[model samples]
Target: MTGRLKDKVVLITGAASGIGEHTARLFASEGALVVISDINAAAGERLARELGMHFIAADVSKEEEVERAVSSTVGWHGRLDCMVNNAGMVGVVGSILETGAEDWRRTLSVLLDSVFFGIKHAGRQMRELGGGGVILSLSSLAGLVGGVGPQVYSVAKAGVIALTRGAASELSAYGIRVNAVAPGLVMTPLVEEVYGGHDAALRGGAAKSPLGSAAMPQEIAASLCYLASDEARHVSAHTLVIDSGVSAAGAGAAPQFHHQPADFLGRLPEQYQ
Candidate 1:
C-alpha cells in the first residue's frame, strides 16, 4: 500500500485525537502531505510535529476557520487531494426529552454543520484543483439504524450520510468522489469520555458483537485510505459500514451471553454482600 496516497495533499479535521489523529498519522505514513486541523492547538501541533505534517488550528463549524484551513493547505502544498471531515461532538447521552435544546444545537453545529461547511469549502478547492479529489466523511452506523444513538447525534450523522450521497452525485461530474464511513464502537478517546472513563462500554460493545472485539482506529484508517486512493475510483455516493457485525444481528440475540452450566455460577453484588 506504499504510495497509495503518495504526494497527495489532505486536510483532516479533529486531527488532535482519536480516529482523526490516527488517520492523520496513517495518511502521512502512507506518503500524503497531511494538513491536520483541530480546535486543540497543543494536541494538533504535537501531532503535526510528530508526523512531519502541517497543523492548522481551526474550528470546522465556522466558515472563516474552515476556509483558512483549506486555503492554507492549497497555499502550502499547491493542491488539495482529499478532505476528511472528522471533527464532531457526540450529543449528551440521554433520551430525547432529557436532552436540552442547547445541547442539541451544539451537537448539530459541530457534527452536522461542520460537515456541511467542509464540503462547501473543500469542494470548491477540489474544483479549483481541476477535480481529481476525494472527500470522505466520518459518519457512524448510528445513522443507519433506528434507535441506535442519542437523538441529536444520530440525526446529525444521518444528515452526513445524505450529504455524502448528494455531494457525490453532483460532484462526480467534476471528478470529485464523495463517500462516508459508518463506524461502530471504536475505542477512541471520545468514546472513552462518553462511556464514563472506563473501558467497560467498549468491552461490552465488543463482547456483544459477533466478532467479539472493537476495531482499532488504524483499521478504520485503512478503509479511509482505500476510499481516498485510486483503488476505489468507482466508489462514490456510498457509505461503507465498518461495524463488527453489530448491524447484522437481531436485538433479541443472546448467543454471546450463553455460558456452560459449569461456568455459570454467579456471585452476589458487593452491595448485597
Candidate 2:
C-alpha cells in the first residue's frame, strides 16, 4: 500500500505458498515487479496470474534450475533488485537414530543447498549488472538455539544464517545486501498438517512465545518487504528474528502448553515448547 518497493524487480523462490506466497503478495502491493518461482507450477502460475506477475517453475534443490530462474527473471524484467531464497521443506522428521542418511541429505538438499544456489546465482547477476541488490533467505528460530526443530532442519536453517553473513561480506562491496529471517512457530499449511490442524497448532505454538502469540506468514512477509526495500540499505548480514520474543526468552522461560481435551489434536514435540 505504501509502494515502498516501487518499481523494484524481485524474484522469490517457493512463492507458491506460505511465507513466500505472502511475501510475493506484499512485494507486489508495495509496487514491486514480482517473479515467483516454485516447483508447484500450477499454483505458482495461478498466483502469478492473480498478481499480474511472472512465474518460473524451479526445483531449487538443483543449481541449474536456480540459475535459470534468476536468468529468466532478469530476461523478463531487464533487471533484478532482490532475490528471496525462500524455497524449503521440513524433511526427515524423525529422531537421530530413526533418521536415515539419504533422508538427511535429501532434506539438506532442499532446505540448505537451494539457498546457497540462490545466493550464488543472484549475487553473480547483481554484480554483473552493476550490482546493488538485496538477498533474503528464510531461516528459523530452530536455527538460532537448540531443541526447537528436528535435527536436519535446524542444521540447514542455521546454515542459512551463516551463509547470509558470509555472502554479505563478499557482496557488500558491490552494494548487494544479504540477510535471513528467522521466525518461530508460524501457522503455515505444513505446520497445520503437522499439528493435526490449525487450532491445535496455533494453541501449542503460540503458548511458547513470550508475546503469547505466534507468527503468521503475512507478518514474515512484511518483514521481508522492509529488508528488501531501501529502508534496509545499511542493514546487511542480519538474521531478523520475528518470533514474538520466543528466541529472546530463556530456555526455561518459555511457557508450557496447557492442552485441553478438545485441544489436544496431536502432541507436539517437547523440543518445540
Candidate 3:
C-alpha cells in the first residue's frame, strides 16, 4: 500500500533534531521525498543520509537562504509539495524590561521572521509550479494563552498564527493550504533548556498537564504529518493546538502575577506596596 505522503516533495527546516527531526523521519516513513534543511549541516546531512533523503543548509530567518532552499528542492525533485516551517528558537527568555532591541529582534528573527520567509518563498514556488501545496508552521500554546512562555517567545509564536491565517486566506485561491500546530508542554531538549534541566522540565510539564504526562515530540510530529498530508486537503488558515487539555483547564507554567509580580515587574507594583 502507498503511504499518506507517497512521492510528495517535502522540505522541513531545522530537520536536524527535536520536532523537525521526528517529522523528517515520519515523512520519510510515509514515502515523502524529504529535504532536511538546517544550520546544523553535520546533523542535517547525517539525517538525510539515514533516511535516504536530501539535505540543504539554510538559515530560515534570511529571505535569500529560504529562497535558495526552496529552489534547491525544486531543482532536485522538480516541485515542492510541502514546506514545513519548523525552524525556531526560544527567543528572549528574560522579562520584557530586560530585553534589548537587538535581543528582541534576534528572537523574532528566529521565531517569526523565519516563518514569514518560509511562507513567501514556498508560496511562490507552489504558485510557480501551478499551485497546490501544504505549508505547515510550528506555533505554540503560549501564543494563545498568557504566562506559559517567555515574553518574546509567546509574541513571536502568536505572530506565526496570524501569518498562517493571513497567508492561508491569500493562498487558498491557488489550492495551497497554510496551517499551524501549537503544542503546549512538550519534553524536548529545547524545553529542557528553558526549564533549566531535562528532568525538571519533564516534571514541571507533567505537573501542569491534566493528563499527568507531558507531550512527547512524536505526538506533535504526528499532527504536523496529518496537516502535510492529503487528509487535510481542505484544512487551512487553522491553528490546531495540541496540549493534552492543559490550555482548557486554565493551567499554565508561569508564575501568577498577583503572587509573583516580581516576575513581571521585577518588583512589587507601587500600588501593591
**lDDT (Cα atoms) of all candidates against the true structure:** 0.82, 0.86, 0.86
For model 2, residues 27-93, the per-residue Cα lDDT tens digits are: 9999999999988899999999999999999988889999999999999989999999998877766
lDDT of 3: 0.86
Question: Deviation in angstroms for 26 in model 1?
Answer: 1.0
Backbone clashes per model, in order? 0, 0, 0
lDDT of 3 at 135: 96
Mind giving the per-residue lDDT tens digits that candidate 1 earns over 209-239?
6898877888898899999999999999999
Candidate 3 — which pairs collide?
Answer: none
Worst 10 residues of 2 by lDDT: 256-265
| Collision pairs in model 1 | none
Expressed as tens digits, the lDDT of each residue in 188-233 for candidate 3 is 7777865789889989888888989989999999999899988999
Residue pairs whose backbone atoms clash in candidate 2: none
Off by over 4 Å in 1: 251-273
